[model samples]
Target: MTEHQALRIRRFSTDSAPVGERFDAWAAHSTYCDMVTTYRSDLPFDAHRDNVSIGPLILAGRTWRHPDPSLAYDAKRTPARIRADQRDFHSFSLQICGTAALRSDASTAVKRAGDLYLLDFARPFERVITPGSEISLSVPRDWLPADTGKLHGASLTRGVGSLFGDYLMSLYNTLPQLTRHDVPHIVRATTELLKASLHPELDTLAAAQTPIRDLLLQRIRRYIDDHLLQPDLTPGSICRDVGLSRAMLYRLFESAGGVMREIRQKRLYRVHQVLSSPDRPEERIRDVAWRHGFTDEKYFYRIFKAEFGHTPRETVEQVRHRRETGTN
Candidate 1:
């Protein structure tokens, strides 16, 4: 409710505590607050703040930012009752960042750009990560498919083909999970993809399909269409806004062919739409094309004819004749 409201619950608080120098605990809970908390993990079990966010899912992440830090944090601890406690949630992690040593229930893995580690939140996890490294979680009991629930007992390693994995990693590296206005929808869409990616049968994943992907593609395209006049709507800007890699970004048009091809096609489509509109006859075709990111008038005509099989002049003439006869 409050702007930038922070709710922090801490097992170790140096601010009001008598001792702040070093904290040593076998295990403890964290103080959660803010859109994200960036933190440190060390023996005597230390904690730091995180800039990463937890949207809809119960996400807790840690990364090293300072020197003199070879950090390790245990999300689940070895308890006295048994080897591990029963975890109800499914957890996943991505080294969506720098380097690190990662440990799952089965073995230790190194962190890389595409490295993914899956685990059971019901069981304990120990991690030794480096600065700029990333950690993420997906609550499968609460998020994943029913049949894929079998994955919770197994250890998660990288190289799995799932959009949930990609989407989770994508959010970590690209989009800010929190926004002044858009956090809700961002969290919703992200979790949808995240849950879908966990299914053994990727077919169950709604995000990987043609329709939803196409829907998002259309949203992005329409956004581009509305903002074509902006000079800075280049690939980098589009990647940032659309939360896609420059390479994967081109795939948005793979459904049609290629990105630039789609851009030109859409531009031509808009140009024709304007030129053919009988009510907008006063608007110049050159003005319409330029408004859609066409810089050269002559080049626009060439591409238009190549695409539409007619020149801009001819298209306008056809529109004029159609308007005169009410047959357009």
Candidate 2:
């Protein structure tokens, strides 16, 4: 496929249209136009949108420049409209330079600049947008973690929300430069980041347990064991190879502190076993530790003592004494 076919891009602007037809033209191009009743302002309407489709995700940058402060537009998605359209996706809008208000059956929120708000297209909602600019991302509902319904119509202004907003902005800025080969990785990373931002808690295994989760966990553990000696082994690599989302992978290992912690402990255990063995008697302790992915001698000693309650040298000495004394 061609580059354009790989990453579809669409641009809509009111600047090229007559002032009288701007609102109609802009609304006609909107993804929500079919499912929403848009109320146009009597004043002149001005808006622009650039949309890029990367895999299953749609990222759009929008800006509205009204000549008067009172010039605003609003849209309402009623139950009838929702039933008619049957759109089931989540839209995360990060306000960059304007303010907006959303009201839904669940809650009401006022989103200011630097705030991010979520909208579920399947739900009944109404939103009023003033003169402002924003980046909006539409993702499949199933891409998000469970229990994200609580985020509907809610605005996130700080913490992980802020970081997610920054990420959305950066992604928007670079969308034009992204290629088809980059789509899958981008989609996975974006989905994982969105899951982490929206749901920061470590979900209990009991809550997320399933046959697939169990199978994935087993596969991940096996992969880690097989690659334990590889110094470059990381969560990212594991996720890519094991076909698991970062959020789900972390949740699977939450009880063990985390995947990285598990990897570290497993590596340390292998090092301990090697150090305690009578074979390869000429191998230096540092070499044994380094072979198992630990490069810093001091850190190796520290963690080795912390894990096994004794220094590496002490363990080696005990093994030597056992060999000399013919002890088991």
Candidate 3:
């Protein structure tokens, strides 16, 4: 194995400082690890036996014994933030000893023993862990596939009573019993289960062109429209952010007729949205289309008819007429 990435670990066993002091203490460690930058201290817990870990592929190492004051952190006024020391790695933290109240990048979630919290390292975020809980975390960036468009910002979990969730719990519960010789196999299994938890549908329909194809196609199409005017908008830029390669990226949209078609479809959808705006009755159809990546009125009209079976002006006229005639 490569050198163990220092998943920064801090244990405040006997510290009796206020929450601000705790914030500074954790912030000091952030400098040592490059993956995280901003640190926000939530919840006022002055004293409690707490241990927090941050790193890639494996962020957890210690278990908190019965050395407690009251264990927990909740960012009331402040939220947790971190920068990825490494670009590709992501994290999945599982509680083995007890349950924890976790608030990660997007939401406030609770994870009990056998349940894992997936944290996006690339984004700035914070997590609040309740005291007296033992955790086993897995970070396996190296295991992720090259084409990850379908996986970017995908929801981070499969709940219990599922195969992946069961595997995660089984792996964590049995890791202590496995010897060093067995680490590789256990780690491999853990990684597989983690991916499965996050991408069950992708696994099933990867070979055949399916709705998984359109889901990603539609999502990417929407993403392009939202950032249509950005100068940096391009296939290369989209691939980088979503973690997909060019070929696999094409495959994801194969069922949707290809990337360009999806983009055109999305642009038409945006055109329709603006033209049907009843609140802006004074706005002309040409100006509305131009405002949303449609610069040429003639070209926009042709494409609008080709895609929606109605000319841009006709659609707007229908909408306006309906509203005026009480037929809408």
lDDT of 3 by residue, 179-287 (tens): 3434444444545555555555566324223332433344455457667656466678766554446776787768778776766676678778777776566776777
lDDT score for residue 157 of model 1: 46
Evaluate residue 14 in candidate 2 and report its C-alpha lDDT on the 0 to 100 scale.
Answer: 90
Tens digits of lDDT, candidate 2, 1-328: 8643346679888988887988788777765733143546776677899988888999999998876655457777777778787888899999887777787885677778888988888887887778889999999888886677677888765666665686687567656545676676667667766766776556522232343345456557767988999988999988766555688788989998999899989999998888888875688889988889888999989998998899999999998999999997
lDDT of each: 0.56, 0.77, 0.51
Worst 10 residues of 3 by lDDT: 75-84
Off by over 4 Å in 3: 1-222, 225-232
What is the alpha-carbon lDDT for the whole of candidate 3?
0.51
TM-score of 2: 0.57
- Candidate 2 vs candidate 3, lDDT winner: 2
lDDT value for model 2: 0.77
